[model samples]
Target chain A: MSDTPENVAATNAEARNERHRERMVRKKTVMDERIANAQSERGLLLVNTGIGKGKSSSAFGMVARALGHGLKVGVVQFIKGRVSTGEQLFFKRFPEEVRYHVMGEGFTWETQDRQRDIETAGKAWEVAVELLNDPGIALVVLDELNIAFKHGYLDVDQILEDLRNRPLTQHVVVTGRGAPQALIEAADTVSDMSLVKHAFQSGIRAQKGIEF
Target chain B: MSDTPENVAATNAEARNERHRERMVRKKTVMDERIANAQSERGLLLVNTGIGKGKSSSAFGMVARALGHGLKVGVVQFIKGRVSTGEQLFFKRFPEEVRYHVMGEGFTWETQDRQRDIETAGKAWEVAVELLNDPGIALVVLDELNIAFKHGYLDVDQILEDLRNRPLTQHVVVTGRGAPQALIEAADTVSDMSLVKHAFQSGIRAQKGIEF
Candidate 1:
């Protein structure tokens, strides 16, 4: 019993098979249903920090997910003019359920006019605030609002306070580098995007539909 | 109430004030209780599609979030073999809860040996499968795996079958450009990044930390 070659091979195979089965179980455990169950009774997420990469992309994923579940979504892009985005284009597929508004003065330098940049931000903030209060709006992504705060175009205190009091049924997502510490502190969940690697580093230019 | 100039001015001012207050209320509604509740739940996500931007960066955001919550995480990067990423560098700060592995045969064409590429992929996948099965491992990120599938070095059906059966407490994330339709369909969530505009198109290379 201890020296049979066939028995040893069979034993080794069984061990390997068990390990394989275990891995499969672990992967399935990570599904959305499990995540939904693990979620807190309240949902308040703040995605902030230095502009590394993919902050807005992650928020967009959530928007799509919520929208798929038949929830309404609203998005306001600060300092980003009316330029089209892939997400905006995709969301257009469900125009009846998604609303997007870009309050952009383009880039700060592009605007050149400080007063105009401020005016544009002010108008966008107005729209953002309106969407924030609408309980029917399940998710709202504030793209690039951090730059507005970092540049003093928007008030951090106001942003945090408003977010703190936003509709209990709505989910707010803010994307930008250099998020205020106060906002981070007030957020129920904070995700800091730290870049690991990117192709652009290799002298490859950002390709359309892949980088926009 | 005389129809005096002062009375008219007072009424106009009140209306303007109400509008402003309404805007504030609207904005504040974005941080609702539902979003907070959702965060407590653990989940798995896969960000994949053709050569685009931010798939890994987006997944890293969740890795950071999960780490902040004291969850164990493991990362396996495929195709990106040569350089060190900021994510790996930062993860060094928390050696106990995080592990990083790079499974690459360098550039595809550089690997003139087809059998060698397949062998390298198989070796790395062995480790990835191990991580996927570990229940104590709360979050697992398979970075740039789509390239393996695209290159036909990895078996998609086998990997999907394993992922589908993984542990219930584990959350798995796969990030790569050009994710197959079958994988997307199998996933609880899928995001196709459409590039619209990118800074690289202007001849600027990737910036450190911002890109890699």
Candidate 2:
């Protein structure tokens, strides 16, 4: 039997597909069992913090994900209110579902006055607490709250207590650098972004839309 | 001088605005110098890996950011090709600029046959290399490539060599868990997601548009 190149390739592909099918069947069995075993469901407490970039970016991405599910989201910015970012503009399109309040006294260096920073952070936390209590909002993003906590502007213990008492089905996300140890322990999920190589280090100024 | 709530609030807001403006002016002075000093610009090699969620989600979010800037983007999925994710469906809308390719034989456990899994991964890497080399593509996302590397299906060194030779402005993102040491070292940016809690552990099934 003479086999042309196309025929030989076709035969090989068919064999591979068959093997792949068998393997997936076995895997599905295992996964099904595991899926069945996991039984509890509750709102998530996700924390994103570190020296690396994308902390706030990831949280914003989740806002998109939550919105894709038709879920209402509430966002409170602490140290980044001064910047009008692309995300803010995009999420603004969904005014009914997204409650985005940019509240901050800028970065610590810019603010200079620690007392004013604390008061502003306190105000932002008040908004966050309101969002957390409202069951209508499915997810609440506490952007840069870690910075406020790190600078001793916001009380971590008080924030943790409030988060613990939030609506049962309302998910919450905290993003910024230097998440406190207490907060980390209280959190259900934490992602510490590691700065590997930054474009800023190479003299590329933060590009619009990319960094902001 | 009776300070009703409205008068007090207005005064406070005006004072805050003045301070904010002054602070921003100083910040701009410093920032302008930094921006002027920064001189290098090149395509970044970013890696998002960890046990937490949002790795691929973050990478895809970058795809959106790049698109917002009118840049051409390419995406190659290694182990998640079977699922029709929200990102896949959304990005598909931009067919002209986005070269989205879902190439995989499913996860390692599902494939069962190591040889077949390896072959699938190799094919995917070939596609990744193609995207990496194509100057027309400004951003290339090798989604779940770390999973292939974690499974020992693809050679890290070979991938690194290709990335090193990519176009100067061609950004690449490698996403999935347990990114090999060499890949992390070579990457310009790395975010190690820290998983504190997972919805799946609580028996909350992955919903459409959120988990897919």
Candidate 3:
């Protein structure tokens, strides 16, 4: 006996539902175990890295999250001082909760002076170190520091040492491409964004709010 | 000739400076041409997908960017209607510019019915379709719609057709894991977030404000 069209559709829907139930049951078991075992809580070291464009964007979003929680936040920028970003402009509205610092001279091409870039990176790192040590600051963002770290303007070892001794209650988010292995090892969470496609590659100029 | 520690440090810094200058000069030429040729401007279909986290967070960051520019924005949340997210709470500050819609029955585990899930997804798509056709809305974020697309609850072809017919000046950002190949191909920009390390993998529970 052949099944009717209505019956076939119902059967297909039932089969899909059963498959979803089984998969989620297995996931629940794993997640429950993980959640049960999590007893210790402390501030996290999060690194957003890779060739994708959303690394810095995600880090800044976390800044918004931190601020929403009534947490004090500090932001330090390195190697990207030419353009004031939308995130910076928006966060400036809340001066009481956010300490914003744009400490880079500019891009290497724009500045063309390695000595100046190094000095600027040094100043930004100084700010980062201070932010990391401040227990009152709940979240600190080291935006684009990975670019300077990649270019050797900043010492990875020194930064790692500072991160190790950061305040127990202060969260830190580091963003940029080519994050060093040491920082990755030291971080509690790491997200590496992979570029499937970028608007810039398609001859789209960096717009004011989107790119900045 | 043997040199003092300070002299060796000074000489090394100078050599490093010289290398950076040469490398940057070459990089500048390439970047200049790339920047010069990038002249196109249009609204984009951006998809953030993969198993890694931060897909929705980045999408919301774009919403903030859109809002910062005083653009009208619409956000539709799918499959995450159970918990209130930080982005939703914060975006509610700008009620005039944002039209927020949470139209899901929670995760599949909680819903457990394929027919119900399909109906919920359809309703969310209806809201998204309305937003897409509205030229006054500068950006529309379809959060977690990929899950519906991944599960066959929604027709990918229908979505592709709708995306093709969307308002010319309106940007759409779709966020979730396991985006279909067709959507990826149709999208102007795509970012695939890869997990290096996740807090959940280390038996860490999702904390309030950070995870939500």
Candidate 4:
């Protein structure tokens, strides 16, 4: 109420706060409507793909969340079996809750045998199909399955068909780079994890319990 | 060797495999050298930010990894205290292993009080600082702290200063949208999660286990 500079500033701040509050009220109404309209619930096909980190990590995070809710999770890692990762070591502890299978011999370059790679991928897919068909498995993470599709090791059409026909209440998270267009189209949620910067590029070694 | 169609295909495949093997051998040498050169090991400042999902989920994944390695973990959630997410519910089960703190009244819009929001963020920062200072806590997750900085509730410079002075082997992961430029520069690794498509956009509600 005073003419002083401090009082004027306070008054202006109050007005701004009032405006923000009103805007938020309008936003809340719209959000409420959207939430109300979204009554449908079922399985989701989540794709975490791109050239960035965290795609698999995010999927693993969901694995943790799923386990928290006492859900059974099945993880079929398709192309990273050379060295054991931290996620593998950690999730394997919950043997009853998580069915984790590290199905790759190693990276494609390391494998270098096309016939063997296809065989390995086929084996992994068999395990994945089993998980997908099981109603008890709440969340199935097909880690790096896209890379198999990208390298023509697995049939994309077949993978899509299997994903489409999975249990009604089961959730699937597919992670890796170059997720096929068809898979993206079939996905319910798709996150493109983009690399902004990497510690490895900055001369930092990938350490245990972090990168792995 | 036979000159039949099957024989010809086998020969071509063998030649291709040989060529690929040679390429991989060369690549391995370069990779081995890079691995040998990266000898430095210490604490890392990691930032996961952008307008997409999984920023927090990936951080949670790292927390799982850290815990898997028998490392102590700490989590401080900012601007997400209104609703108890699955991560919070799940992580809270491990009281001895995890020092989890949910320190926010709600989102900024819901709170509608700048003073209160700032105070809550300051309190969260206090908890974060404690985690950062503890050398025993191997990994500390500052979930949605970037949003607090984005809304001007906390000082970026001060946050960076604390991060820089943390324990020698401590690893920190900050997750949320609009990570400050300073924080990104300070980070060892930064991932920008971009939304390709979201289920909520397709008339699906945020589910209990997946979204939370």
Model 3, position A107: C-alpha lDDT score: 86
lDDT tens digits, residues B12-111, model 4?
Answer: 9899878877876787788778878887888888899988888988998898888887889999999674567878878888999999999988877677
Instruction: Flag the better candidate by TM-score, 1 or 2.
Output: 2
The model with the greatest TM-score is 4
Model 3: residues >4 Å from true position, as ranges?
A1-26, B1-12
Per-residue CA lDDT of model 1 for A1-212, tens digit only, reads: 68499999988866765554555355445442443454333435546454344667666655544553556888888856334555555555566777888679576644545456667888999999898888888778898888888767788888787887778756677888888777666654455544434334333333223344
Q: What order do candidates take by TM-score, descending? A: 4, 3, 2, 1
What is the DockQ score, from 0 to 1, of model 3? 0.58
The estimated TM-scores of all candidates read: 0.51, 0.76, 0.92, 0.96
Winner by DockQ between candidate 4 and candidate 1: 4
The lDDT values for all models are 0.65, 0.79, 0.83, 0.88
For B1-212, candidate 3 gives per-residue lDDT tens digits of 46999889988988978888898899889988999999888888889998876788787767766666667889999877456766777777778889999898888766667778899999999999999999999889999999999878999999999988988867888989999999999988899999989877776666544566
lDDT of 1: 0.65
Residue B92 accuracy (lDDT) in model 1: 52
DockQ for all models = 0.04, 0.25, 0.58, 0.69
Instruction: After superposing candidate 2 on the true structure, give the runs of residues whose Cα lies further than 4 Å from its correct spot.
Output: A1-32, A81-83, A196-204, A208-210, B1-37, B68-72, B81-83, B93-98, B126-130, B133-136, B196-212
Poorest lDDT segment (10 consecutive residues) of candidate 4 chain A = A19-28
Per-residue lDDT value at A31 in model 3: 59
RMSD in order of candidates: 19.1, 7.1, 2.6, 1.5
Docking class of 2: acceptable
Local accuracy of candidate 1 as per-residue lDDT tens digits, B1-212:
78699999888867765665555455445333323333333344445453444567666656655654556789887776445665666555567878878788675544445557678889889989999888888878898888789868899999998887788656677887778778876664455544433334433344323345
Worst lDDT 10-window in candidate 2 chain B: B203-212
Candidate 4 structure, TM-score to reference: 0.96
Fnat by candidate, in order: 0.03, 0.36, 0.51, 0.63
Docking class of 1: incorrect
Pairwise DockQ winner, candidates 2 and 3: 3
